[model samples]
Target: MTGTGFGAFVRRAHDAGKLVVQPRMGMSEPDRMRAGLRATRDARATTVGTITLDSYTRVGDLESAELALLEGVSLNGYPIVSHDLATTAGVVEGLYGAGFPIQVRHGSATPEAIFRALMTAGLDASEGGPVSYCLPYGRIPLSESMANWSRSCELFVRSREAGMDPHLETFGGCMLGQLCPPSMLVAISALEALFFHRHGVRSISASYAQQTNADQDAEAVAALRRLCAELLPGADWHVVVYAYMGVYPVSPQGAYRLLGRAAELAAGSGSERLIVKTVAESVRIPTIEENVGALEYAAEAAARTPVEPADSDSQTYAEAAALVDAVLNMAPDLGTALLLAFRRGYLDIPYCLHPDNGGRSRSYIDSEGRLRWADIGKLPLGGLVDTLGAPAITSGELLESLSYIRRKFDCETTV
Candidate 1:
């Protein structure tokens, strides 16, 4: 995590021509929109900035962000990929307004209902039709029991045959909420490779987010190396350097350094495209200035550092790779594999209580084999009956309060 060491590595990768994709989290919906627009403008303004992959939580924000970028930026026919449907609309509309063709992210790998949603969303937003579909939850586990994978894959084939370009995104190190772990991610990556063999994709972007510590992340990286070797032996691909800006507990300086390290590793390993995240995210929602500041930080660091190979002999890397393979082979179905991994605690993303869960959240299992819900509620001590006024208010205000928060933040947010 040394700043100097990691920064130099990132710079070297840029010098060698790699694509770096930075995730600038949105403080509010508006801020997220603004960030997306600014990203496209910045990318189109220079050779260094060619294409930007933007993410949005809601549809309106996506439209707003893409509009902002389309209205101002000029590109040499580069495309922008949005992780949300709303953002896809904005991109399509922007492209039409800018007198260019629009591309949509049609995730045909999802359920029929979801695929229909994507198609309907695309048709509603575009003039010529959607050109691309982005699958953001890393790779799809092709276990037979998961209906989503087969449906989506079939759609991908249909899309390709119809001359539409489809893209597969690969996850980086850490496991985000409900998003599978690196081991599972490795399985999905393998699945994508097999899918691509039958139906050629327009491109593959490794949207690598640095998760966990250097030790854990390095292990995941090693797993990726093995996965690539096994899944995509002779396939041509491009690399997208996704920097984990806000989530890590590390300092902004340390985060940038880690990104540099990752970029160097990717380059030495033969990745072709790279971009750096702007350095502003050390906490919740970075301002535009912070975004600019962060990107500058990574750029300056890269300029000073330059990427090179780090020590590659660690056993952690090998062990992690084996773990990934083992998990992929353990189950007959993707959903079961995923559930089994969760049962064994293979993938553990923090589960906070529903905002309505009155803030009560817990991870520890009780000795009685029961899941304990951490009570975040501030109730008077005596006992549950006492707190509820001798059980008279069992379904009253106390119940109402607990009910509200759980539904608000907990149930709605996570899977």
Candidate 2:
């Protein structure tokens, strides 16, 4: 059987009426990393493999990563550039292909080096974007990240040229993790996917992270799907939902309940893949067993829950389409259009601190816990921007909104 691309693999699962599960797992030791991959592969669920890079490598500090390796320092994630090609290849030997494709996840604004290293090590799938990887993670200048990602996207396409298809996932959807409105997330994800498609990638995935409200999240995913179908016509794409990337619940039961809801949301909203967060997420790095358990749990939740397709023609869709169109109409190309969009306030992420970001926008969770725009800057959303009604959210309310999901899930109904 000819194993199709990573995007195809997820699409096949979605077509087969299943959701593919993934974990945010990474380890510095090759043996541990290999073990994690093997465990994910053998888990009682449909899964994809991830090798998240350490902070040193993420910031383009290969020398620091190498020094930590030699000094036996415990790094947070696998240092892809620091490892030799043979070592990285051996870690995924016989593990990356067909049923399991490993995606190199690095939080790098400058991912050119990361892309080159992963491609050389025989992996072609990775995630990040010029805007998403830049604004939230570091202080890297936006233009530099844009230039780096343009080069990285071109680097990603080399896999297809080498007879191995490559996949690029956009981290745009999960920007700022929580409190950012669903419309902004959907729009950014679509824009980044367009950027990737323009850079010669044939397979891509647009990501959406679970937010405070289930109904709103479902609407956002549906909106994202519609926009992607309309904008990314020539590319193979899928929506991957990350389980609440914000403040996680401390209690195991709360964590499990939240994760189960995430799976249900993914299945109902027609997302092909769901990224799982372990019960230990609030405390520390999860073990392989914890990750495997989370995967299985998510899979089981997805199996029992019948899908309820969201309405694609909803207001969310209209708002997202407006945002996307406004940005695309700004300039001829997506890369430059994105930069100009931010500069002109046509695309503004709420609470984002980047100098490139307009910072005029703000979002707050309403009484129903649905994320609503407290201010829209100049997002070109027409009447939708008026949803930023009345008095602005106080700092205390902002704190409460940030902890909304965690507080709800962690409250005890049973002793």
Candidate 3:
């Protein structure tokens, strides 16, 4: 069978009642990269391939990447820009098709060159957003990142002229991976999806990372879906869930159990795709076999997990809708609205250290293991959420909250 574009491929899989699983594997060597993709395609699950970019390429340091390639030094990920088009294409020449669409997962705030290289290499899908890619990853001014992403989106959409439908996933929901409340995560994700849609991207995916509480995560994902349906009038969109993105459990059993919970979250919440994390996540980068094992395990877990009824009237949905509406009312254009929202502290992320961040917001893990807002900053959720008598989270409490999942899962495995 011939290959299909990334968005269409994923839509087909979800429509066929399969939850697509993907890995975050990348290599410096072309042959090894090709092998990784091959393994993913051959794995015993519905899967997609990822070519994560190296650090130098992610920061626009092509010179260092080229030097490392020449000196035979191993970089963490595939340097797509430093490597020639022929070399990059050869890595997925016969492997990338409808059955296995490959996406470039680079965490670059300024990704113009990265997008250009991926498009040249015939890659039709990538993930990252202006705000989501910027604040947590680097010190690049939000304005600059916004301008850069605007150009990148314009460049990515041009693939349509060549009969390829380009796909972009928002990393907004997974911002900082943990500690932030579900309401903010859901709101940012929906806003970023709206940003992509406004920038002419027709095929889009909104991402949400699994937080501490399963029920809360389910509520958040449901809220995100509802917001997208109401906001994105005529766009092809889906929800993608990433396994717990904070500190992972150290034990093998704990890791597997955590991954299983993530798969269950995706299935129960009706998310179309899941990004799997291996058992070696806490120690080091996982091997090809480990990634494959994680993929298969998640697939098995998803297969038997039944979908739960969505709660449309939950607190998550109410708060997220408020945040999105507040931001949209800030300005005429989505990008400008985002910039103005951050500048005015209308959307503050708890515990995020970037200078662009308001830093006034703070969150804590409640007694029931649910993430709750300790301080809401200038966010417009005052009416929906009451932080009136919430105790301020101390440094000691913050550290413990950061490792909440790791401790919970690891302790459970040992017991």
Model number with the top lDDT:
3
lDDT of 2 by residue, 240-284 (tens): 999999999999999999999999999888789999999999999
- In candidate 2, list every pair of residues with a backbone clash: none
Which ten residues in a row are the worst by lDDT in model 3? 1-10
Best by TM-score: 3
For model 2, what is the error of residue 195's alpha carbon versus the real structure, in angstroms, after optimal superposition?
0.6
Q: Summarize candidate 1's per-residue lDDT along 1-415 as a digit string, tens digits.
A: 0011122223344555543334332322323444444554354211121122233312213455456455754221212332355654554343222212122232222334433443543321110001012122323332322444445545643544433344444332322312223333333444444444334433444433443333444444555555555656545444444454223322454545555655554444444333445433334444555555555554444444434433434343343344444445658654455445434544323232211112221222223312122331331111321222212223353334323322322333344
Each candidate structure's TM-score, on Cα atoms with residue i matched to residue i, is: 0.50, 0.97, 0.99
The global Cα lDDT (0 to 1) of model 1 is 0.37
Once fitted onto the true fold, the runs of candidate 3 whose alpha carbons sit more than 4 angstroms away are 1-3
Model 2 lDDT at residue 409: 92
Candidate 1 residue 167 C-alpha distance from true site, Å: 0.5
lDDT (Cα, 0-100) at 92 in candidate 3? 88
Prediction 3 TM-score vs. true? 0.99
Candidate 2 residue 371 C-alpha distance from true site, Å: 0.3
Quick one: how many clashes does candidate 1 have? Answer: 35
